[model samples]
Target chain A: MAIFYILLLFIITAAIIAVETKNLLSAVICVGAIGFGASLMFLFLRAPDIAITQIVVEVLGLIILIRVCISRELTFISGPREFFAVVVSVVIIFAIFLAGIKVLETLPAFGTPIFAEVPDAASQTYVEEGLRKTGAANLVASVILDFRAYDTLGEATVLFTAIIGATVILRKKTKKLLEEPDV
Target chain B: MKGMTIIVKIISGWVKVLIFLFGIYIILFGHLTPGGGFAGGVILASCYVLLMLAFGREFVEENLPLPLASKLDCVGALAFAVIAILGLVLGGSFFINFLYQKYLPGEALNLISAGTIPLSNLAIGLKVATSLFLVILVLSMFRPDMSGDKKE
Candidate 1:
């Protein structure tokens, strides 16, 4: 537990440094540090899959962000208003997620979330019958691919949409479009 | 963009194969191990990212090409969807483990005993690897104020 708190403290310090840094590249590296710190925390919590994911995602995101910061005149700075709006939007999104978790029965729930009251039906089913049903040693994989497969499909579609959006936005312009005067 | 120096190139060249193998191991043994599609896919993409860093973007892009990666991405997604649809049509439910009780029936904990999970992981792994590679490639190509709308 003390180690967990130390990891948390490290993450907080990195976050502060990330926010306070003058150099864009330093800030980006600090963000990566925070991600690695969180990944360590996840490992201590006995979730290696999430830890691996957090670390790789940190690497990928840092690569993208550093690419943007490199070879570009750094004039992008967010003011207090933009920060406040971002905070509000994030809070609202979390609230929506919380509401969805509260109302949706299909969403997975933990037995401890309700103070052990009634031992969550969905997760209980998974624990008792998941291995026998799916034949997969890793319950996480079985649950992700079998019982909640629609959810996996949704996630894949989301990724596809993001890639498509990035491609469309960053694609090179054709000759006709470039020859025409800027609209 | 020009790649890094000799040390980075030599080290990454030797290390990239091992990393690629590790990513494949993660995806293939996902049902038996900790990592699944997403983690393995990111690892695979990072392998390519390392190549891009060591050998330059122009060389990497020339090998993989944008259109081929895009098609592989679509193929991965389509394969996943088709698997789910097959379950619905054959087993009478969406995403059902039709093979678990039939052709895939065997002892538990084996590599090939996870029914559709390994297959799904393979598809998702392919999708994620190609999608992330495509996104990074496109983002790397982005040069603001080039021939497009002038931000100045």
Candidate 2:
């Protein structure tokens, strides 16, 4: 568990360096690696749901970044002194840690037996009738798709919106093709 | 083109195949394991990155046609929606596990069970693969042509 934190810090450091680096392509690849490392840390913390979500979202973000770089010829140019960057990053990390610790102190133990008291009547019913009624191997899938399906549908619609948004932003300049008078 | 070392070529080939095999394994055992459709899909897309590194963008684009890939993505998304629709028609809630309850037998950890989990994984696998491939392909197409550079 301690090692997971170490890995997380290391990944964060790598991501910072990647963002500050002068090469766009290397930064993109490093960002992807950082996402993978953070996901590994999430798994170590026994939060598979968060890990999966992080992986998917991070990958999507990276793909978008890479596309932007390729289309715009955007290569990062390293600026300013290294000391300043390090100082700023350290302050940011410390502030985040302080905020996170404060937040953590206020929350109840998520995985303890105490939290289990909240009767999952809906989840239990699904587990009981899922196989016979829905035939899903994993109960979460049944819950997401069957019981709480409207939420999933809403999420899918959100994803569709993002896709449309990305498509609109990345739309190629058709004037270049049209103006080139019949090749 | 300059000839590469034999070791580089062998390692590249091995990495791609390993990632591909591991990805398929994850998709197949998605119900029983830590990974599922999304993870498997990303793993599968990584093989193309390996291909891009070893053989370049042209090889990837040639192997994975853009129009065909997008169509596969559409099909996979439709499959996901259709399964939910089927549940609705069967008098179950949208994306219900009606088939799972009827078909699956034995314990929770068993492979033969999980009803539509496997199907969902397959659908997601296709969607992930096609969409990621399209993204990479489209991006690579716009990469600056650096053919005239001298060896560093």
Candidate 3:
């Protein structure tokens, strides 16, 4: 759709601004804008759950980024070698993008349920039986919490582990602060 | 970090309560709505972050305290584990809908009819909200400049 294409363009532009900006604060703000644009795209795709999650996660991530940026000096200078590296990376990324487009051309058009001559059996089943099996009106919630509960548990465990790791790593600084007197 | 201006503080004072209530609503209605534990939890954490920004670290510490948040984080995880374990004990499977047939007897789309789902959402919301707040609180404690750093 034209609207989707416009949203995609906005996201791309925001991403470019985020990457190209010299000011860390502006870059962070641009990244947040890109996230908002992408969440809008998710909404356009009929995924309100993902859109909500994306927006909230983006805001939290932006807060952390701003906190980090506030503590550190902002300027980042690139050497010739770094510029060369960027060029190489951009070329490699373009190559991959072209390959992806070729591959996509071989597949069915977007939003058409049939894929590779086979029906979308998994989604069809979830759509048909999700409400009856889970007794939750929100199919996305039922799918994540009921049918895919194990995956959700694993994700929760992963989050817990990340927090634990952060705590352990940061605990040392606090302990060192407590043990030492004022300099 | 120092607190923000007086206008910002006064506005955040009023807004934070509404944010907390909205987060609770999102968590409670997760089963029938778009939002779930993770989104609601992040919103709740944002409330704490807002308080920290508006009222300074000392004020937030006086109200919530880091130790209490860490304890709540552990409790949330433990509660989630207990819910899953209960399923295993009663239904013979991990994270099964054990309470569906027994307690939550109502028509679909009702708030009280989602079996263990609402309970799981509550546990997860608590865990996520507390853990995220703890992360931000700890990060805020670490000053980049040791010479200028002041421990509260």
lDDT string for model 3 (B1-152, tens) is: 47999999999999999999999999999999999898899899999999997888889888887777878988988888898899999978988888885666567989887788888899889999998988888787775434355432
Q: Estimate each model's TM-score.
A: 0.84, 0.69, 0.90
Per-residue lDDT of candidate 2, residues A1-183 (tens digit): 578669978898888888777898888889888988988888888767558757865766686677567634446565667898889998999999999999988767645543345586555667677655544565555565556766655654564455445444444632221122344
Docking class of 1: medium
Off by over 4 Å in 1: A75-116, A172-183, B144-152
Candidates in order have lDDT scores of 0.86, 0.67, 0.84
Q: Candidate 1: deviation at residue B90, Å? A: 1.6
Docking class for candidate 2: acceptable
Best by DockQ: 1
lDDT of 1 by residue, B1-26 (tens): 48999999999989999999999999
- Put down candidate 3 lDDT per residue, A5-115, tens digits, no spaces: 899999999999998877878898999999999999999999998898899889889988888787455356343457788799989999999999999898777777573
Higher-ranked by lDDT: 2 or 3: 3
Q: How many backbone clashes does candidate 1 have?
A: 0
lDDT of 1 at A140: 89
